[model samples]
Target: MPTFNVKLPMILSLLLIFLALYVLALRGHFSYVAMRAGNYRFSKIESFNSLALNPLMSFSFALRDYQKDTLDLKPANMERLEELSKIFPLFSTTPKNDFALKNPPHIMVNLMESFGTQMLSLQEGNLNLLGELAQHFEEDFVWTRFLPCQNGTASSFFCLFFQSPIVLSKSKYKEHYLPFIPIEVYKQQGYRVIFLTAGNSTWSDLGFFMKAQGADEIIDEVALLQDYPNSSKIHFHSHYGVGDEFMYQKALELLSSAKEPLLILTLSVSNHPPYPEVPILFSKEQIPLEIFDKIPKNTSAILNTYVYANNEFARFLSKVKQSELKDKLIIAATGDHRVRGVAMDFNTEKALAYGVPFYLYVPKAYQGEIVYDKTRIGSHKDIFPTLYALTLSETRFLHLGGRNLLETQENDKFAFGFNAEVWIDNEGIYPRSSNLGYKYKDNQSLLSTEESFALDEEHLEFHKIYQEFLELQLRYKLLNLAQ
Candidate 1:
């Protein structure tokens, strides 16, 4: 019997060897193995291979125990914090003026899914993508040069909420109480923070994270269905949950009955993929044949969802404007990241790939002498700083990173932006993985990389300091969590 089981033992031995190699590759001990392993996605695999690889994914989390040894970095972190404080001040005191309201306005941040400028740039006379939202964009403040902190939805959401770029994988935010959390800041100022989403909050443990970050209420797909039984369901993309209109309708309901100042963060999922069936309210646009041929195969499906999302948002705004909350609300909307299906040459079109629109609609009552510069380059980090400046008065909030885009001068040295893969400033966009950066003009459409366009010493120094600052901020958070 033992001799007959030789093949079983051989297979077990090979499986053990493969697992060992996978662990090594995940740790990046072998360059070739690491390169190959980096491309592995368990979602794409449809066999026993996913099960085998699943356990190994937790290997990265195991390394977090080693990172707890960063207590020694405290002094260095303190020095960096001091240096950064001088550059980016923590407290934002609202100016004493007539524009300052007697009470803080309700802050509404709508995170539209895949609302990229690259696709919007394709909107010509015949090809209308914006739909009803076009009129609002022309009237309100829309910044085209803005980028998201990360390319993925979850990463960008966390980046904006925490006001930091360092997002730990599989880490429970409940364990770590970061000082830079925007929800906590809003809570401290007596504002009720509500996180509304059209998708399941349990998708990335986002519900738990939002609760830990001081969100007063979380309205997800389950909550929406419980409240409104007749709400629309996502027929095609059931995983994405209800349509955008239902989620926005819930927000309007909350605003109508709110007693306290509110900070409602709405995440719309209708614009995601595999695209949901277009709602009845969506008006289909005619895409030009010339531009149609250049896009991905599912361009029609993508545009339908995009235009639907825009129409829903515009409808939401119109309702808000008609309500009594019109003069008492501050709405800021932006995309989580660029649309995924569009192809871009990374060597030249990196900015276009990362570019998303930042649309701000400040109430006339709250509009001080603030200069609105649509050409300024920024990312998700700057969103809260601008919001804090407008909403809070003389409140001391932690400035983890980013400047107040409204008050920051054009020549401000700290006016640079750091997306996940690139560093953006007045000069151009610099990809972190590459030595050479590209120079652009007219809102990053035209690119040039001449011999004189190399990253200078000053740029290198800024990058070095910024990278270290991010690491220190993360280390400090970990140290706080350990305590």
Candidate 2:
């Protein structure tokens, strides 16, 4: 008993316990671990154990698995590529000329932050979330059954430009020059590609990434401040920088002095979280009592910013419509993701949770026989393909996986969100987490999920094809990175 040294053993045991808890907490914070198991405690524990054993060991195991999968799927990748090439032709030298415009219309893509359809669809008699943007939804072509490429702002933005999901560890932007990027295609067609954002471009390496992808100019918050010294900053969460109104003003100025065919991509920031107080001209009394009850405690602030973003966008659209650029511009706008902080059951409301409106305004000159089918399912990936077909002539660009939404073919009318873990079609919505699918009815004003049901074979087949397409894209990306 004297030689046992119980105190030393107790201290060592305590230290070991502390170290174990520390490791668990540390592992829990890792993005990769959190991404895999954010909700489930058991899954998180497993992830922690795997990480604590050896952090690099997981990577090693993943690498081995990837290698094995690559070897087995190499032939399948080629086959898939060939099949996809036939579906989405690699070279479209002949412009669709449906609009028969005198000149190639200037392309303007507006990426609205947190403009979630869940909140937008809540617009009833008095509860108006869109504000000034409501009329445009009626006048322009908007696809209600739409999903974004991913849920997060940065990922959605990257996917919209790259036509593929962002690879977290080694992004294509970091590894190699992507040949099939829309910006590069626009550049090759003699269009000056400019990216404008009210937020800091360096936040997610956005400016660098855009420049790498062949954007001629990246006008971010720094440039915005320099250009418009009088512009007011949203100091509450200052990373978002100036308001959307100022950014739109800058865009207007650029449009006036354009020397060549221009493609301007504007990313708005006012609708984002930590919703700061902006000039709220709209009345809060418009919100219906029932709808107001559903939102978070900061409903007033969130709605104010939401309306502010829409009002600024509407003002920009009105100005463009009144100006000479109206006839020369092809405007496309969509939300980066659904508005966060909304409480909903994912099992029942996956479509509503991830839904975003895809609004398009093609100049009258280019509006050939385009049928604005509101029921067609689409995402950000389809935006460029539709634009390329409209504006480019005989340009050869790689079509990773997006279908031209303008195409009348019903075969490819399906929306899939790889990062959002959801797939939707005319039949039903299939979330990756469950075997049962949810049926959603798209109405004139709102899209409401009805009941949980089983997916038909056709829907299941489409989902399978989508999964294969994503896999092929990932494999292709990994191989490119390895090279």
Candidate 3:
């Protein structure tokens, strides 16, 4: 009744105008969100969705255009194509290294959850809750900082095992079935490949993926429950299933009965929250109440649970030391990703979250030949190639695209972050979607926005090659070649 005085055509025109303005506003907001959020999701959506109606998609497109303005390297050239082919060669045809060791040591990879090295130290009361484990690694093993391929647990596992970037787009993931994973490689080389994890493998489709990759045995949390239905020790954490101790116990049982050379991939849990109320290891009550009281409640709870898990690990290691399997095992330890907290800034937290400690331990027999360089920067992609180099018959390239950290220098090294969206090198962090990046020298320090626009052709080439390599790998996978 109030609008009866307005003309019908005039009202329709006003409505259309308002709709257009609303769409424009939404587009602007979406652009801002894409730019702020680092465009990981934007990249995924853009990969397949040509009709991306969301304004955020438009914003992501704009940001990417700005980021890639100067870099126009194409993979279509014949010479570049050939180079990429060599860099990411056919998996089956890739020449195997011959280390010539009569007895290749049994390899064990313990991929720990939320195991960032940001506050980790040897001191008590700080994040160095794993002081004993850190000390053991420093004194006995090859210890260095390694970045994860991505932030999530599944992504980290995919990067480590598949030796490739973990692309989560529906189209990309479905098309690319990587076969260069360590499980397949170990199985091919006559090593019994066993996957042990405290979480649900089905959570990430890795249960089926790992099976397809030729895991001889896949023991996940579901299997644990089925095997130990009456055990009181089996309890689930919110994110990580069951517990670390249970997984370790099961691993030990497998180790004792293992008849062949084993490649046991053990993934630990209990580091995730809601924190478990496990018994304290040391006399924390001895510490001054003032010290404990001053800390934030959330921080205190996280640290307490963390220390408890560390204590459990120490106990597990002690058991390993006393067991006959100690000498036969080549233990490789690393965190899946950095810890996430509300206090942390997501952008700056990249360094903290991705920069996890990597420890490679060879018995005295092989330690002499292996160089334990603590300075080199590496990634999860290097896990298999390093293991291959350590115990193989000869020293040849695995062609997994990761450098053998033992042989590569820190200055020339870099790592890919989650779907190759970001590149971390010695100089700084470069976002693939935007030219804008953060430059930092130290892992703990905050990365400042890089003002200079100088593009390192080497880094650019490396990034292009990596991206093209994945694309070609997917094509090869679809054709069922070199898989």
Which candidate number maximizes lDDT?
1
Residue-level lDDT of model 2, residues 1-483, one tens digit each, is 367556988999999999998777644443112412111121113454344434444465446545544222232366666586564444444354534334877889999999888887566766677888988888888886778878888888877876555533123235345665688777876789999988766456576667766788878755666677666443322335677888999999998889788899989988877676676654567556765566756777777888889988988998999999988988999999988877665644677778788888888777665666777777676788778777765667665555667765554433343335777655567777667777665444224465778766755565556656655665565454446
lDDT digits (tens) for residues 215-332 of candidate 1: 8888886567667666543352343667888899899999889999899998888888777778543222556665555565776877778888999899988888888988888999
Q: What C-alpha lDDT values do all the predictions have?
A: 0.71, 0.69, 0.58
**For model 2, where is the 10-residue window of minimal lDDT?**
35-44
Arranged by lDDT, best first? 1, 2, 3
Tens-digit per-residue lDDT, 1-483, candidate 3: 365688899999999999998776555333212222222222222343234335675676557645645522222444554567674543323224343266667888988877776536223554366745755665555434456666777667766766544433212243344554566667767799888887655445465566666777778765675566432342333334666777877888887788888888877767776665555443455443543443334555556556656666666676777788777777788877765542444455445434677777666665434444665556676666667766775433335456556653342533333234456655566666655446664543324343435566765566666766665554444344433
Off by over 4 Å in 3: 1-81, 85-100, 121-127, 142-144, 167-177, 226-240, 280-297, 345-350, 395-397, 408-422, 429-453, 460-465, 478-483
**C-alpha displacement of 111 in model 3, angstroms?**
1.6
The TM-score obtained by model 3 is 0.68
Scored against the true structure, residue 130 in model 1 reaches a CA lDDT of: 88
Which residue pairs show backbone clashes in model 1?
A: none
Model 3, residue 321: C-alpha shift (Å): 2.6
